[model samples]
Target: MDPTEVNVPDVKDMNIDNITQNTILINSQCESERVKYLFERLVTHLHDFARETRLSTQEWKAALDFLVTVGQISSDDRHEFILLSDILGLSLLVDAIDHPKPPSSTEGSVLGPFHSHKAEVVPSGSDISSDPKGRPCLVLCTIKDPSGAPIEGVKIDIWETDSSGHYDVQYAEHDRPDGRCVMTSDEEGRFWFNAIVPVSYPIPHDGPVGKLLKLLKRHPWRPAHMHFMFEKEGWDHLITALYIHPDPYLTSDAVFGVKDSLIESLGSVSAEQAKAYGVREGTALISRDFVLVSDDETQRLRDSNALAAMADLFPGKKIKLLDHLPVPDLD
Candidate 1:
């Protein structure tokens, strides 16, 4: 049966109850009850959304072309589609809907395009600072309970851009290391780092996503932030990004990563504390703690990690590991 020829209810004549009744009727016959129910709900909502937005023919065609470009540019080595979704704020919305963490816990943000699996894991107090010429930063981090008591033995995987606001992936040939650190907290639940202060930077604007953003009159920049993933044996593994409170794009990040709870002031560290952390004078530091809820679904959390790891595992069949190796900065 042709859907266009069917006597579907018109937008002007539709009400919530009528839509609900139609949805129930649509679910009455199907090979899979689950799929029938799901599609019924989805169709009604999608129809209502299109009607409410008054979707235009030109706008819809543009949207389809944008998505086609996204798929066209994607490969095993690159996921421009995910990057497109991220810049459009769709990725964050999906993450929010799928994983509703505790209100007091750290909020999840966009898992940016450059997340690599090859980061070297370091222990507490180990310096993973990549470039020495960049502005010095001492990150004093803690993991604790809601009452503020330190929660020892928590592991934190971290990464950020350099003073120039470029990630390692951007300078594929330059070989400079932008701050990428993986460390665990000590017995006192404290982990301090000596790193170059990260700078705000634009998202990759040379790609299709950038062109789309230009068409929409949106910038291709994200606010200054440090990515952090916290994990513990019995606690929920939290993946989040912390934004510098004073970042200019706090209200207008191109990637829409900014969240009110994730913003924290990068305070001035006293000379004594700086010296204790081996940070020289005049260097700035940011201090913040993450709180994680206990993880009851261990298998599900492990499965998610396994999936991410597998997705990024192998390069093309014709390419060798060394062939895809990033150039190291010999200078």
Candidate 2:
């Protein structure tokens, strides 16, 4: 029973097309089981999509070209590929699946296309805004554990758009770092910095992603928000955002990063009035606290899953499952 020629369609270079989809999924045998499974599933879905869409060779070539352009524009300071994933909602989906929010931990959001390790480390309440055109804003934050205890010495990296809704990366000659800073928490896990209140800005549409959005009739505006990357040894790194409440795009963030829990309120204050708080009188004030989970706490939560932990809710009493009943006739 020779199977290669029996069931296989007889044609020149027949395996090239794989139109039958019976081709054995070929992958490296060295890959782990999970990796192999993921690769095979991805291939299956992609091949199926091509077949179902009856994708023409021209369309496939166009997609390849589009990707090439995206790569051409991406560099050390820019990430056009990440921008593509963001607008397509894949970034948010990946984050949600990878970091499912446990208990009181802060929710994660997209890191966006513009983040740089070049941010300068500064003291608490230092003015990070080199763009004098930007409106002054005082941001105060505290990091604490789920048990309401302070987590000292956590490093907080803050970055946001200029008052004009433009990041430092957008400007080619802005050699000086503005609108970004790295600060550490005090003994009380408190840290603050002075900057501009971020404005809702459009994701750069000058590249292939912009063309895609134009063809799809979609907007690329991210709501007003700030980015915070909280990191410390032995603790889960927090990549999250604080979205300014009442932003017009809150309900429809282009990257799908908005969450109700992340919404923060802003207060307008005078520089003289802010003098009491030790800042140079920032125009807007934002005070919020972030909760981080320790590695041990995360492990404990994992060992005692949600359902297991709920056992205490009904001490020794078994909960009954309700029966499913068929729909009654309206007669």
Candidate 3:
């Protein structure tokens, strides 16, 4: 259905009994048909929510004030609104809806607010971890096609908190060499690095999100995991995490970002095994491979990634026909 067709709903004569008609009237002002449809649907649901809860004027004002504080606290280092969305699991839900992958292809996960364009690039096999705040760990990753063919020259960006559960950005110095670095796959599609094993950490508190959690009596912890982003031409820019299985929070991630297929085993290496890995005893090891879809099937995905990479700033960027897909009817 074309939401912007001639049948746009008008609510100029609407009364309290016909408040939903106001939403269709709001949709009439949107130039893009997809935007019109989305605004109409969102306004429809929002109006329903207000009616169902019988929300009062005071409650609405309080909600708006809370959101204003969230925006006031947001800055380059911290995004309180994203944190609010994470605590509500909306971030993961949006990711799943926007990027569905084949079983053979790497699954997507939350691209947590920590992604920085200033990631340090390190040579292959270099230690991104500055010191042993936690136990030593070796990470070995491989990138390949669904058919197990190696994909060389693929850029792999990685970052994680140290065992102390503190990201480099949390410190006073702007340039800390903690558990984070960027690397690339070689001819064999392999990229290996040394880092400290991460521990589960609470998402940042001291904001309105934390206040909401207090009101809801919810814990604010995420599972131990290393963030990975794989990008290359003709492939979907895969944003995912290699979650360390057995983490206590695996089943109860505060953000609901865990996927069963993304869970992988991590084990401690002995002296003999550690020697081959070029690490001493008591080093944890990670071994996993990611599969990418063939180029021919990724046109829509490529456009999506390009739009995202540019922050959707392309000139006259309208919703592509590919994006006008029918909303999945969960009912």
Candidate 4:
């Protein structure tokens, strides 16, 4: 482990032309091959971007400053980096890459910065809404495997914004949890709960990511949707949301998290039917069946060249994995 015995090439007098090569050479000495491969491409792309754009020193400094601010403002309750990733569509891309599912299975979406782990576990047909202004809605969901068999004992976490388009956490007082809860699927794979009909809302737009969005001339609104996270021992953990159809921002969600299959319409419920679901009259109903992929099936698909399978999921798009770059000859 002597420093003199280290095999990294000399990086002295690095200029624009040789700086990337020398950096990659140093990174190649990493003990982990995966880390080495990742940094090599990362360094190559980062340097290429600087060179291609002729990025000025001031611009580089500003970018670093922006990242610093993003970190400084993030806390236990808020995640600015995830917001940045979502805004840049990286979150959706990563989800698509790692959680590839069959056509029949539900697709994944962004787990936004507002997710709270402190949600209370509630029984079926319980109302999670705390805001009186929000319209009452009954969400009747069924969980099943890809083969259409009911999967019991699935832990499902659900959350959404109230009628005013703001989560409970977004409020200044934010003392108690509302509009979010955790429930277990019954033996029939059914779990119904009373919640407010979610309305379209803008993401937290008072931070650096919001500034970037403004700079890019983009709106910060997301479509009306309810978030759902499903977990079971044998099934793949699913993170998805059901978007309300005819939403203004459905086609142009700021986070690019919407998929055609996830769009659903709210059904009208009769007074008796609403009462049966434990909600008041004129309550809207969202009845949807979620199909989860098993871990074995997910692994099989992942091992069978997920990049190739992604083509079917994302039609009319070319997906490419980064090819390993040849190490530079420093000799």
Top-lDDT candidate index: 4
| Top candidate, metric TM-score | 4
Can you give the lDDT of residue 220 in candidate 3? Answer: 85
Residue pairs of candidate 3 with colliding backbone atoms: none
How many steric overlaps are in each model, in order?
Answer: 0, 1, 0, 0
Candidate 2 lands at a TM-score of 0.82
Cα RMSD, each candidate: 13.9, 9.5, 7.3, 4.8
What value does the lDDT take at residue 35 in candidate 1?
55
Output the worst ten-in-a-row residue range by lDDT, candidate 3.
322-331
lDDT of 1 by residue, 67-144 (tens): 888788665435787788888789898676445565566778887787655567777666666676777778888887
- Model 3, residue 130: what's the lDDT? 78
| lDDT of each residue in 70-171, candidate 3, tens digit only | 999887767889889988889997777566576779888898877766688888889887765677888878899988999998888898887778777766
Clashing pairs in 1: none
| Per-residue lDDT over 1-331 for candidate 2, one digit per residue giving the tens place of the 0 to 100 score | 8766454434345453673344323452424544544565567778878878988999999999999999999988889999999989999987765455686899889999888988999999798887788777888789999888999999998999998888887899988788898999999999988788778999999899999999989888889999999899877777899999879999888889999999988986666657756655546888789998876665444444433533555455442211211111123
Q: Show the colliding residue pairs in model 4.
A: none
lDDT of 1: 0.72
Cα lDDT for residue 286, model 4? 90
